[model samples]
Target: MQTRSLWEHTLTFFPQFLAALKEHAPRDATVAVIGASDGKFVLPLAAAGYRVIAVERDPLALHGGEVHLPGTAHAHATGLIDRLRLEDLYDRVQVVEQDFLGSEPLDRLCDAVWTSCSWHYSVNHRRPLAEFVARMQLLVRADGLFGAEFMMPVEARHHLVDHYTSPEKLSRHFTGAWNVLLTLRTAEFTERAHHGRLQDHTHRMGLLLAARTSDHPHPHGKKNA
Candidate 1:
């Protein structure tokens, strides 16, 4: 399968973006990576010594390495984990191949939550954004960090169109639950072979960072102090 140029660009920038988030994160903090897709962000975080739980939906996407198409890269959470040579880290790192909106229990409270362009495509976009933010907030301790990158243009003719959200819309989603730290919009250009004609287009990429507003009941019944 052919890989989209946009996905390539995203992969290139992910390391730096994640590193920035890590730099600001507390040392040895618990982290949860949603839409982990091959553990690209998970492995590096593990190598950095943070307790991490990676959630993804497709098991094959995690294990099928270079054999899978770029569109499937983020769909598979296991691929990146296996590639990092840190499989034994699973003891400290958990990989859950399931939908994020489902009722599965993610029992650990975390200091950081990382999601790379995955929230917009969840099965329950219509569900109250507050509820979703509340769920994530509960997973993170007071003063913990949350970071995500979202696609701004839903009109982009790509396989991930179903998962894209505009900056304006996402901002409102986080308004009450967290403080917005950063919103960076970068313009990207791509040429697609459509109908045997190369069509060049540009789209916006948005990166967002927020901090959980207040302390919530940690699953372990211990307060974040």
Candidate 2:
């Protein structure tokens, strides 16, 4: 049986991003997945012949372990690494176990980078949204793809946090050497209860796909024109 992620059923714009990546990046390109949970996106990238860097911090999410299921149920869930091995894709993926924000720079720049609804978690809110975006951006090589699907403001509290943002607002960060390729947003929608969230909830999501047009120095490092 194919191993599935806890978020397998969640709505996402990842398919669109993947299609774009295939068009822009070479078949053998290296792609990095930020907050890669249980190999959802990582597996597909690897299976498509792309070398993947899977960055995830949660032990249970990275390596197999028993866990509580939806309600009053428990199961031994297959984690990202085991899943990759199961499908013979392990060789194509390098699992990096660390908190993405606090982790040191990746060993090498990637041809493309993607993150899905990762930075909106309560734990991540402590850091400014710009930090999360800048970190993801830094991982991409020049002329590479940068894709992120984020939670837009839904709850009253969400409105107060900049991390819960729309595509238009998020696009501001992709200036200078970056070119915005696509921006998409979803209307408020209901999602069924899942592992971590045991109650059904409503959410709005936004996707921003951009490409680095040139290798420009970091804003702070740039010399005066």
Of the candidates shown, which would achieve the greatest lDDT relative to the real structure?
2
221 in model 2: Cα distance from truth in Å?
Answer: 11
What candidate 1 gets wrong by more than 4 Å, as runs, is: 1-20, 65-81, 84-88, 122-134, 154-163, 191-203, 214-225
TM-score of model 2 (CA atoms): 0.93
Model 2: weakest 10-residue lDDT segment is: 216-225
Q: State candidate 1's TM-score.
A: 0.70
How do the residues 118-190 of candidate 1 rate in per-residue lDDT, one tens digit apiece? 6655464666545655566566676678777765663635444434655555677665556777667677655
> How much is 181 displaced in model 2, in angstroms?
0.3
Tens-digit lDDT string for candidate 2 (1-225): 377877789898989999999889888999999999998799988988999999999999998788876776788889998999899999999999999888786756778999999999888988999999998888887778999999999889989999999999999999998999999999999999887888888999999999988667544432211
The lDDT for every candidate, in the order shown, is 0.61, 0.88
Report clashes for each candidate as comma-separated counts. 7, 0
RMSD values, in order shown: 6.3, 3.5
> Largest TM-score belongs to which candidate?
2
